[model samples]
Target: MAEFLLEALSEEIPARMQKRAAEEFSQIFTSELEKVGLAHEPANCFVTPRRIALNIDGLPLQQSTVVEERRGPRVDAPAAALDGFMRSNNISRDQIEERETKKGRFYFVKIETKGKLTKDVLPAIIETSLKKFAWPKSMRWGSNSFRWVRPLHSILAVFEAEVLHGELDLGHDKLVFTNMTRGHRCCGAEKISVDNFAGYQDQLRKARVIIDRNERKRLIQEEAKKLADAKKLRLREDEALLEEVAGLVEWPNILMGSIDEEFMEVPSEALISAMRSHQKYFSLETLDGSLAPYFITVSNMPSDSTRDATIVVGNAKVLRARLSDARFFWDQDLKSKLDERVLALSKINFFDKLGSLGDKSERLQKLVPTICEFIGLDNVNGAVKAARLAKADLSTMMVSEFPELQGVMGGYYASADGELPEVCRAISGHYAPLGPTDACPSEPLTITISIADKIDTLVGFFAINEKPTGSKDPFALRRAALGIIRTILENKLRIPLKQLISKSLDEYPHLTDSNELLDFINERLKVYLRASGVQPDLIAANFEAGKEDDLYRLIMRVKALEELLASDDGANL
Candidate 1:
């Protein structure tokens, strides 16, 4: 048995596409190997921005030799036919045997085919795998009809530490295989030669390239934290961004840069969003948990004081430009009270089928009072007031630029406008628990507004028959349902889905989809409950009892059934 290594070097693949491409390409190759009876050891795949390397160990030198019988014409067949069969099998009449068959006597020959060497078979395997490989988005490079995520440059194929002979036929060009591979685009050597996987990795590292993305991520995190620690600050942890940044560089050099004090005055979220989204820079925080006036960026080159200073300065200049736009939106937005932006909501459509956001805002104002029934019975005029401005920030310039900060900026702007703290918190948190792990809002007023907003959205969309289909919730209606379920259950609020949904459907005249919307929410509840360790059968049993709209009570009944089922007396029944 020997090892095999194949590396395909290409132009920079988009950071988001790099890992998946490597994984899918690895799967294709592994499948091809199995199809050819090359049952090898597990394969390890490595990816960077510019290359994908695969290593397979303990593969056989060649396939196993096999013996089989081939049938020939009947004994009475013509001499020409018998001669043709003998020639095809490379045998003589003495080598042939006469066999009695149901039809008649026939001629047969025993054939032994030699196993092909693994090296000889691998080129065809590699070519077949490459042709079968797919990308999320691919492009044709130059005039070549064959496509890759980027340009297909060079291929490195080595088996048993020997360069394998192979080539991929591009429609307009051909890529001959070689043992040669290039390193980092700018800082590394132009060309490097290797024999085995270990030497390939070592040579690439010496040439200023890191073949493994996880190692690059680790180096980036450790070095970045050290840099922040030196300045009495710490790096903000974002695993997603770390993965992305790791994909953006072959060699990560962590460096810290200053943030202009004037730009720091902008909301940290806005500044952080600008840095992360536009430049992929990670933010730092001070010892007291305040936003630090510095950012960490990963460079693809070595960290030399003279040259590194130039890179940091260049990165800071770009960041300064991005933050300036964020700052301008902040400064300009605060000039008018957040309430003044409510009219602008009319100009922004919530959905093409659903009315404008202004119309939805009006619906929310009417919906919150009904929602206050389950959360709080007494006067809810204050929550209704908060609900009126829940979506006001959707029209703000800052939100237009950074749409992810819609509710967050609204909360900030509302505080600046001297709005009640209750209203600010309510508006800001109305979109909480966006996903399964997101924090669910517990404050009564905030919960009230959130439930109302989500319910209104669910009703309007369902009223128009725009419910989410399998694996495709274009409007994220499932998330909205999950949000509502999380809020009701987490807050221990007793909400009757049938009644609340019926009342919400009334807000949209001539629409009678209350049962449909309630069923959707109930399905989401089942999903949420199953994730929390509840039995699906018990939940369904409780639902089958009919009109079990109060989620809290329904859950209590299901748990009671589960406990009973666990008991001997109930088990007997």
Candidate 2:
């Protein structure tokens, strides 16, 4: 038994690409080994910004020999046929054995294939795997036709105590395989030799590089928490930001930086967005859960006193510039009422043929009242007001700069414009339940407007024949449909989707029957129900009972039926 270690060190691969690349490297390597009948224990892959490494253990020194039986021409066949059979099997007439069959006697040959040493077969497999490795985006570098995510610097291929010696033809240049790798580029670019996986990891760590991404993530998280706690603040949890920052560094040095007090007046969301998106910094919140005037930045360098101060000051300066820009957008956007920006939406295209956002907003304003009437909600005025102003912020300078703040900015501007509080809340909540785990709107006005917004978009797109097909949902119609399903189901809304779709389609004179839209909604409902752990048959049985359009009622019936089926008599039926 032996161990194998392979590392491909390169220039910084994009943080988003590292994990995927490592998986590809491991999969390709193991698959190639499998094709050659080389069995091994479970393989592991590790990725950092600069490298993808793989470690395999308990691999046989050589593949097991295989025996194959080859049948040839019958004994009574012509000499040429017999000759051809012997030639094809690479066997002479003397090597062919006579076999008795029901029809007649035939000639058969036994062939034994000798297995090669693991070290002998691994070089070609590694090279072929490297050449065929897939990357989302790759580039050819330095006159080489071979492409990689970045310039390939070295190949470290070791099996047990010996290096797998070979030359990889990377088109313009050849990479000679060796058991040598370099550690953290900033620490020292000196060659580090290793005998096995453990040695490789230990040397890399000593050289200021943490080869395991999960470990790097843990270090960043723990250190950031400690730094925040020391200042009586808490770190705002951002798993996505943590994952990305982990990939951006080999050695993470967590440092706390101060935000300018003037910038704190900007909405915490805006400030946080500016810091996280632009500078990749994590915002800190005070003990009372308000935005603290502090942020945490993870540096790729060591945390020496001088270096820490320099990195912190530099990041703080960068964050200040971003927050200043955010503050400017915030102030400039408040200069006009949200309703005043409504007319400007005429210039912003909603889709290719669906007219401008102004057109959609108009439809929503009309459709929301119908939805409110159907649901027997008396807040028709508030729903209509919110629907009208929901997308008006799309024209605001703040939303233009931070497109993610569209509905959120509307809420702020609506409140500033002295709109009803319910209307403002609805305007902000219209885009809620963005995903399965996101919160659904509980306020009556907010729920009405939210459903109205999603329904209008779904019907408008389906009418234009732009509905999501398979995996090609360019317009995210599936997500829109799912959002509608989740909101209705979670809120236990009693509105019939069929009637609501009909009313929404009526707003668009060119659009006709809501059958297709109803089917799409039903499909999304089944998906939502299944995800919520409801049995498919139960959902089908409930739908089969009719009144499928009333989701809340259908769910109740499904639950009741599920309980009935759990009983002994009902189960027997």
Candidate 3:
């Protein structure tokens, strides 16, 4: 058994792309290894903003020779066949052997394949993978036609505790393989030498780099919480933010900063989004669950109390500037009534092919009443009112400044405009069950408008034949479909899928067959059920979306059948 390690260290990779790039680098390399018949344990892939490294263990130093028995033409077969077999295998006829079979004696050959040295073959695998690496986005720098997620700095490749000799071509330049890697750009040792993965990780750690993203996340989370807890404030626990912040630093130093009371009066969501999106800072909550005056940030700098305070003060200064801009957007947006902005949406195109957002807003207003009537929602007025104002915030200055606050700013403006509380809630909650973990909108007005909003967009897009494909969903139609499914299941609404789709489709100018859109949602149902732990076969066996379009009833049937299949009688049957 032998060990192989590879590290591609470069300029900081985007936090969003680091983990995926690391996983892909490891996978493509291992698969390339597989093609050359090198069997090894799973690759241990580590990632940070600066580097993606892989350590593969238990690999044979040389591929084991393979022996295969070949059946040739029969003893009396044509001479051409014998000659062809010999030529195909690059072997002489004398190398062929004779074997006795039940029917008759037959000509056979035992072919022995010699194995190549793992070290000799490894360079090609590494180079091929590096050349063919798939990055979501890549760039070339310094007049190099060779593109990477970032510029190539160095390649560290070692096998069996020896440096694997290789060089990677970078269009105009080249990266020679080495056994050395540098540590933290600012703090750690400038140069570190390593012979194996164990030593590499240890040396890198001492040099102030934690390559493992999860460990980085753990450190940030635990330390951020500790910093917050000491002041009797709670860390807001934004997992997505935490994952991203972890990716931004090789070494995380948690520091807390104070917010001004003036900015605290701004909606917590706006403050949180501004901090999160602009500064990558974590918002702290008070013991009573109100937004605390303090914010927590993960810094890449080394820190003592004095240095920590300096870092926090600097971050706080930046935050204050950003928060001031956010407050300005909020103040500017409120000068006008929420409905006064509705006309401006017409200027904002939903898509060139589809009409303006104002058109979509009007469609939503029309669709809401239909949903209210279909679902017997008595808050028809509030639902329609909410639908009208739901997208009104899209044109607001605050949402333009912080797009994450689109629906959130709408809710705030609706409350300021003194719209019904239900309407404000409906507008804010409409984008819900954003992903699997987010809660579905349960309130009547919310459910009414949200479903209407999703349905209209889905049907219109499906009509345009702009459906999401295998690798791409530019419009997030899959998420919209899943949101619809979850809303129905969680709210136990007895709405017919096709009827809802058809009503929403009626609002569109084009009328394609509704089947494709219906099927798309059904496929999403299969996905949703499977994610909820319903067995695939059971879902396939029980799913009848076309015949039973009522999602609540459909899921109920799936659940009942699942229960029956678990019983002894149903199991045997």
TM-scores, one per candidate: 0.91, 0.97, 0.92
Q: Candidate 3 — which pairs collide?
A: none
Candidate topping lDDT: 1
Q: Mark the 10 consecutive residues where model 2 has the least summed lDDT.
A: 510-519
lDDT of 1 by residue, 1-573 (tens): 999999999999899988888888899999988887788888999999999999999999998887889999999999999999999889988989999999999999999888899999999999899889988889997788897889989999999989899899878898998999998899785899899999999999988899999899999999999999999998999998999999999988999999999987788999999999999999999988889999999999977999999999999999999999999999999998888889988998888667898888888888888888777745487787788788888877898899999899999998898888988998899999788888999888899889888888898888888889889999899999999888887888898878788878887775666547877888888888889998778878988897667888887888899999999989999
Cα lDDT computed for each candidate against the true fold: 0.89, 0.88, 0.87
Candidate 1 lowest-lDDT run of ten: 509-518
Candidate 2 residue lDDT tens string, 1-573? 999999888999999888878887888889999999999998999998899999999999988999999888889999999989977888877888999999799988899999999999999998999998989999998889999999999999999878998868889899999999998898857999998999999999999999999999999999999999899899999998998999999989999999989988788888888888889999899988999999999888877999889888888888878988999999998999899999999999998767899999999988887788767899777787888899999998888888888788899889989999988899888898787678988888998888888888888888888877678998778888888777777777788777788888888886675548887888788888898899989988877765478877877888899999999988899
Candidate 3 structure quality by residue, lDDT tens digits, 86-176: 9888889788998899988788888999998898889888889999997999999997888888877899999999888788888888888
List pairs with backbone clashes in candidate 2: none
Q: Which stretches of candidate 3 lie over 4 Å from their true place?
A: 68-94, 100-107, 509-516, 535-546, 560-573
Give the residue spans of candidate 2 off by over 4 A: 100-105, 513-515, 544-547
RMSD for each of the candidates: 3.3, 1.6, 2.8
Candidate 1's C-alpha runs over 4 A off are 66-114, 377-379, 544-547, 567-573
Among all candidates shown, the one with the greatest TM-score: 2
